[model samples]
Target chain A: MRVSLFALILVSGITFTTAQEKDELPALDNPHNYIKLLAQDAALPALQGEEKFILRESWWSGRMEPGKAKLIQVQLFRRNAYQFWLAVPNRNGEPIINVYDSEGNLIPSESLNFEGTNIVSTMIQPEITGVYYIRVSLKTTIESPQDWAVIYAYR
Target chain B: MTRFFLFLAVSVLSSQWGLAQEAPVKIDLEDPNLVFVSDSVIPIPLEIFASLDKMGAQDWGRQIESRDIRLDANRSRTAMLFGLVVSEGFIGVQAQDKESVRRLGRDVLALARSLGVSAEVEEHANAIVNGAGRGEWEMVRQELDKTRQTVINKMKELRDDELVALVSLGGWLGGTEALASVLRDNYSAEGSDLLNQPELIKQLKLDFNGLPKRARRGDLFTQVSQTLEHLESLMRSDDTGAISEGKVIEISLATRNLVEAIYES
Candidate 1:
């Protein structure tokens, strides 16, 4: 399965490289745009309450190959609840989200589990005030490199 | 099948929640089980203290109140100064200090000039000044945020990512100083809790460590890095949710001294 996925990525890269040679814009421009918008849209309702959580304005965006992950470093304050919203381009790949503590131990939060969805959210009550890493990964192979966006809020 | 899986996941999650409610999660700072890969920061230092108002902490803006800042003609210093001034602008808005905001607007322009990027930021700085004069606090805040973003984007375009790190560090330090000052006077479990940001200090360390040796070798950067390391150590020692008052005082003094060193020198 891994070999097949690697082969698929090579084919996708070649196809896109060819498209670039022909002067046609790649299918995903500013690849992280759609996922960013998804995070923002999901966060709108989260912001409606009287208790406000500051949304970090600069949304995190990146492209990931299948079975690869990007780590977003975040400081989750103690005594507050945090929600991480992730979105990816449609059919690009499955989204996987996990949170790890400073020592790299996976903090067992329900939000870490992926149920085969493109849009996923993780909510964690940080047991301590410290740095936590949010790992966003593409769980499957797609024809092209997938772009992903993640936005988080705390209250 | 997807629906069935979703239902099962939700049930499992619900049970986890129930167990969590029965026994609070205990985090051990010294636990050797901590593990993770390398990371990138989200950079939200300014907003970390939004709960201060609810906690009824005293407002402290004195560190920025009077200072003759001597800035060398260095791009990195100027960039970090730009972030410090912008963060002060935020504090001015919080305190409703129109004069400080206006002064900070001018300071922003001066730093931009020192960095040789004044043209890109002059308009926003001027708007911030005008907004402060007219008591448009919210508008001033918006312009301050815009000004920082503009400067950072321009710095990136110029390939001065070292400047970006300084900007983030300066801003975080400035914001942290303000919080520590407030918490110093009004020490409470909740108020002191705001000072418990080990992760942010860790991220700042990473930012400095990520810098090229040339950018990281200066005296000012060295001092700032040392201060951050101290704070990180202090934060790691306290695992309980309630931070001790003595530690709060220690952190407040350390942060104030570091802020003065970085912002004034």
Candidate 2:
């Protein structure tokens, strides 16, 4: 009886460990995959319609801790309207994204955030052409750091 | 048996603990150093070009300059020239000059070859030629953007971050030079506002200073460094973010001189 109980416990432990490994592997091995998907999904609507925006070929990615923001400074022109998408993996909580002008003023933007999704976005049309900062942060319950990516499109 | 159950319970409880700790922490917006600046995202040439178009700036055909690519043994110079050629490709597309586009495509391939990344760049180069031949201006622009990204990504994979930055700097200078020229001819406060990129100039200056000592030893690099300093000073002179027409002309002359040196030297 004792031997049977020990064997059952051992088998259960092995199975649990394997399942945990499987769950953890994807986030570590392919960090960008989920974020990329979320970004694309968030961008799909803007990409359609008469004034479709062309996505920039490159994107910015980095790891962010909860409560701390990652700021990306980019030049925005007066005539163009831009939408920026901030995406993270499902393991993380929803992200908060905001755009600030050169004088540290928060520029009002049309924002998109769907419930139960780990993505948030904002759109801005600067009245003056200059450098603008995109601030991304996570509002998370998890203590571990989260990886995030920001992709923008302009029309 | 009891110990195993206890371990499992602890594991479950710990995870729940993590989930329950969801109190939101306020981020101080006024703290200037609240967030460390992430990677610098430089504006590609297309953005500025699109802005210029929206401004109704004409004579893009006149902005296209012919260049003879002098194959330099220095990879840095070659990389810089590669960016210049790509920027010129955008001009060609703007001008809708098929011949210039084709030639610039070939120049891009040759420069890529010099950088030892021709294999990855060839397809885009060919597509650029084909796209221009078919008068697919938007396709050509996309291809140009792809070609630039491919080279930069490959350079990054090779751990040549310096080359990656030079390529970007080259492209920006090329675009800015053209923008300045366009604004010079038809000056507007709104149009000249595009030239008010002092932060970008500062970032490029940092990239220039970050280059390897050997890479920085070249005459071309020296000229570029000096020009960037002068440009930064000019850009910083205005606090209100409005670049005067005279400042735009100065910027045009400065960028034109450096671009000439990049090709001629």
Candidate 3:
């Protein structure tokens, strides 16, 4: 009986450690995944028939509090049509995305509103190559942090 | 066999228990964004090359004198050379130069061996050479991208952050040199826009400052910083990040001179 108990304890310890390691992995089902989905959705209706060269890295995600602004700086290349997607699962937090050039002047861009959807996307064609800062903000007054993600692809 | 069965059972039960504990985290089932998809962000070198390629830049490999870059004991210099070689691989694909691609592949392997990362790089370089032989441009590009990422990830794994920064700086310079060379010969409005990268300059400034004092004091780093400052002024000249043709020439010359300096020193 003692030998059996010892085996059981060892098995449990090993299994627990294995499970703990899996749980400690970077959260896969977060806002970043959502941004990727939105990017796929944008590919269909928006970039239809265009050969899409999807950039599958550099997706940035963070928690944004209501009534606060978060600025993410990204370098964009010239002469490529880039589509940027911003989305969150929460409906109470209305998120707006905008792009600005290096001098902080707003660049003209077309944005798709999320009236009944959980995703917002924008497409910009920078005539010149340079760094552009994207400002994402929540318009609501919720105290809880809303997880958000921004992703872009150029073709 | 009995012990194996018991272990499997325990693992399965433990996983189920973990799911049970994680179930109460309140994930919204109705959210359409919950549908998972596979994609990743674009790296800066790839972005720059894509833009340059779109603007009808051709035979960029002729502009890259990667042969001049030498291997060194300093991991930082080695890392930088690796970046230039990978960028050269991209131009080889653009130029469809099989011999150059194969040579750069072997060179990348040599550099990786010096940095203690030959294991991860050997396969990618082999695939790159093999792909180039078949004129599989897309496959070669993918392998090159993987090679760059693998090297950077290995550097990070070894806790060599300084090398990581230097590798990127090297790749950036290589890409810039290629682009600037094309622009120098064929000055188009669209081609000039690709150099409007003030944000990258700012980030590089921060990266340069973050380097260890030993690396920061290095002559290469100091000279690169001076060039970055010059590029920054050019990028910020207009709100739209546009630069004059003359400014483009200046940057192109500065970048080419810097690349030469890298090879000489």
Candidate 4:
């Protein structure tokens, strides 16, 4: 099965290098590529809108266990609107993404979830500028771990 | 686990209902197990630069300072200086100073050459020059960002993770220094709030600590460490508090001195 998967990846013109020691699932090596693509796709609606949003070059990616959440801290400035995209490629689960202020208060944001894709996004224009935490989690009945990637854009 | 799920469901529903209209759901900020994923990638300088513009920061030309960019023998210092030069390029673009942007483009090329990644960035450097000459400030900004990212990616390909961190740190320090200067000149509670970045400072401190012994043994490194410590203290807030104007001035001076040291000393 591993060989067949490798062959399929090669046939699809996707590069697969040896997995990093920290990664538990070798089969999901380079899963970031899949999730990144999905995240970009999810960002299309906002990008095509009248507002000019520059997609950041940096991104966050990691694996999460079922029912657990991953938190990422970001420094956001006031007056600049930001949209965060979270993608779990080829996963059968609902991904939840939320933004919170340093004081643990949840910031109100517009959440976008595509009907047929495992990509979710949230847009927020922070009232005050500071460190905002983005929490990502997958709601799934399966016990298997999931790989997730988050990319954000700001205007 | 069930309890966590219940909490998650509640949090989702509350968020969906608009937290402002509903009672805000507070998370356990004191949970020891709640580890934030260590962000390996520091933000690019342009993000902060954009914020400065939105905050009614004017006279960007005054923020553009002439720096001595003589090649350093230390690879780490060179990489850092390279990052600073790219940041200055962004400032030049912001100020619409074409000559400054062109000179910075040349400096970026020289530094990239010193770091042995000139081949990777020469095209971007050339494009920056051409774009500046044409007075295409936006194109120049994009080119500058490309030049910095190209160098970082090349350094990573060469397995120079330490250089990568220094490059990012260099750019960040330059950006923060410029921000503090602008904020000091035109103090606003709203603008000062931007400096509340203790978590980012802590992450950069970890980067400094993670540097190899040889890389960390220098006056420049020492000053950077001290500045990081000072900034962390000033920026740290136990509660949601705005950074004060006096603190902004202190931050400005600290970052300016450190930036000068990075470039000169």
Candidate 5:
């Protein structure tokens, strides 16, 4: 599953490692080929040690009215150059991703827009080294009396 | 004995609502359980508040307000403040811990007046910046209510984002009664009449089109969404036929995700 595009280039020094297991995998042009999140799993194997959170996956909900705005909280741990992807299965075709500096300011709001899915992804840099939050809720004007959002994050 | 039982019942219901808020460190002014936690903010530079005031754009060298300079330099420990700012704009706030995040949220709420959407926002800004005391919570609630009323009142001031309410209500069935009540009270009959008239729904479609092309997409369930919302609102109008709290909870969950994602966020 660790078929890193960059790693393949860096390890080019080795003459033949037999193309690695990921060779059997197609290039990630399709959502079907992309890695699927099946559980509340650790991101990147905890290289910086254990970081804790309350609700990390699609595990939370908020009460909002058609006229009131609500913010959903997803907390991230540690500050590093890491990517954050957001998806709403019921929303627009692509995910809107925003990259931020360590200070939580936007670097850019990017989109991965994986086909067949409505997910947004971005790279984030935390201003500090603790839990960072992402708001996954509705704007008052866009709010349906029945509308809310679902979000999950990986470090 | 009945009084004792009633007391226990009230306490139990309130406690459960606290559990439902889902925040690891939620401080609800409305919740009785939260009274145990002290309401104090970790003070920072008044310059921080000043900087936020000037944040309309990403100007590299925008001048700061002179009042902020005096407040920043005042450094009076005798005066403490209730915070009314949301933690979003502050640098690195998105990265803070739960306690820290809640503190920022609480402070922001306390400083709500300082958030100054108007020139009068400047007058109360320092009072809010200094923080709201127990005497101020009622005013805060009142202020929030007035803001809600003002928005509903100025429906012609409605923009594309304002369309959120129309769609969420889903053809006036979900909570049209509740919305109607709000609208009639805030907006004139001339203004609010369209809220119920089918012609307004048609006008809404036209208005929605005038928005930015890529601003947002109609929901996946857009096909039957309007019908469903109208049905829900109609059902809601009659309190007797309403669904149980559990199913209503499920619908509430769906609405929050959809409405927030499609319109709000």
Candidate 6:
């Protein structure tokens, strides 16, 4: 049997299938089965199941010394898919955190507030199975003024 | 063993892919009068001084023409304190060297003029510093008594009793020097006369005219301006505090001292 999976937008503003829908869908009924299909939407490479494997960490003790950025990278993948997310915590004042992608591409960084700290999390949705990488650094301010965030990801 | 490697490979591959990876999302966080929205989804208090006003709609028409040069009271206070410290700490002359003392005296006069202190004190302070550096000790000693009374009169408009105590202590601490080397160059007669004179403590009470501390907190543009204007004329003060600077340092000093002493003791 074939059924059309309509996009019933969730109220949480995140446009991905929730747990309930994932359970009911026969396409994913077998946990042992992996998906291989045509390009449903080529532009939508993110197939709407990320943030699940996001690493979880409890503490960032703020031992960040001068001239440093707390770098964080979260990578997710399946057999034929690769996904990546990278972000640096905003440390306000004169310093800031810089973010870089797997290909060593530079992205803009941000500043933290007066308390002089910030945290960011990465959630990547995989479309094709491939390996991914992330690089993070400080774009502005003194170096190493922050501590590394606890990496929280699903085992 | 193959299956275990497969499982490990799959798990490693999964970890590397970030399976749930999605494009970054950002909410249009609007702050009407936000000061430093430096972090988080949380809202912080507004610094409400510049182009942003909480009450009115953001007039984009005027915004293009407008500048954020509304001179935040915070910036003014910070800048003023910096200026005050520079003036007091770095600009004054000691009896270290003849040429150096003359240079410092010149610099102090320039700073006083630029900072807009009254001309009388400026000139008197200049003459004394210069004369003492020149070994014209009598002229230096006379100006000391004059500056003492001048600064004392300047403090009278203060409503802050605590601040008055601070200024009093500062005056007394500054007193020993003012009579010795400082006054010796300006006023030798009153130099020894008021060295540790208990009567000189009366200058602490000179600050009775400024409004109560609480009244000084709000819309200083309205309150501080009007009150300072009235008090300036009453005290015969210069137009230094005429601008609605929320921080009147001289006024704050009297209150700051007493509060510090209280807190410390």
For residues A1-109, could you state the per-residue lDDT of candidate 5 as single tens digits? 2345234323322123333475453333322212222111222232235542122212223233433323322222222233444443334322222332223344333
In terms of DockQ, which candidate is stronger, 1 or 2? Answer: 2
Overall lDDT per candidate, in order of appearance: 0.68, 0.79, 0.68, 0.80, 0.29, 0.29
Docking class of 1: incorrect
> Between 2 and 6, whose DockQ is larger?
2
Q: Which segments of model 5 are wrong by more than 4 Å?
A: A1-155, B1-135, B150-242, B259-265
For candidate 6, report its TM-score.
0.21
Per-residue lDDT over B107-203 for candidate 6, one digit per residue giving the tens place of the 0 to 100 score: 4344334323446457666776677567664344334434433433343333323332333333332222221232223322211222222222222
Point out the worst 10-residue segment of candidate 4 chain B by lDDT.
Answer: B15-24
Candidates, ranked, DockQ? 4, 2, 1, 3, 6, 5
- Report the C-alpha lDDT of model 3 over A1-155, residue by residue, as the tens digit: 22443343353221222334643422233335544454344444454456765543346677777766666667787667777777765766666776766666666776765443445666678866665666666766556777887766777
In model 6, the Cα lDDT at residue B181 comes to 30
Give the TM-score (0 to 1) of chain B in model 5: 0.30
| lDDT for residue B246 in candidate 2, whole number 0-100 | 89
What's the CA error at residue B13 for candidate 5, in Å?
Answer: 41
True contacts kept of each: 0.20, 0.44, 0.28, 0.47, 0.00, 0.00
Q: Which candidate do you rate higher for TM-score, 1 or 4?
A: 4
Tens-digit lDDT track of model 4 for B130-178? 9999999867887887788778878878999899889988998888888
Candidate closer to the true structure by DockQ (higher is better), 3 or 4: 4
Give the deviation of candidate 5 from the true structure as CA RMSD.
27.4
lDDT of each residue in A10-85, candidate 1, tens digit only? 5323232234554443333345543565555555556667865555545577777776556677776665777787
Residue by residue across A1-155, what tens digits does model 4's lDDT show?
Answer: 23443444554344556666744334434667656666776675676667778777678889888678778988887778998988886557677888889888788887776645477788899887677888887775656777889999888
Show model 4 residue runs off by greater than 4 Å: A1-29, B1-24, B236-240
Deviation of model 3 at A65, angstroms = 2.5
TM-score of chain B of 3: 0.79
The Cα error of candidate 6 at residue A28, in Å, is 99
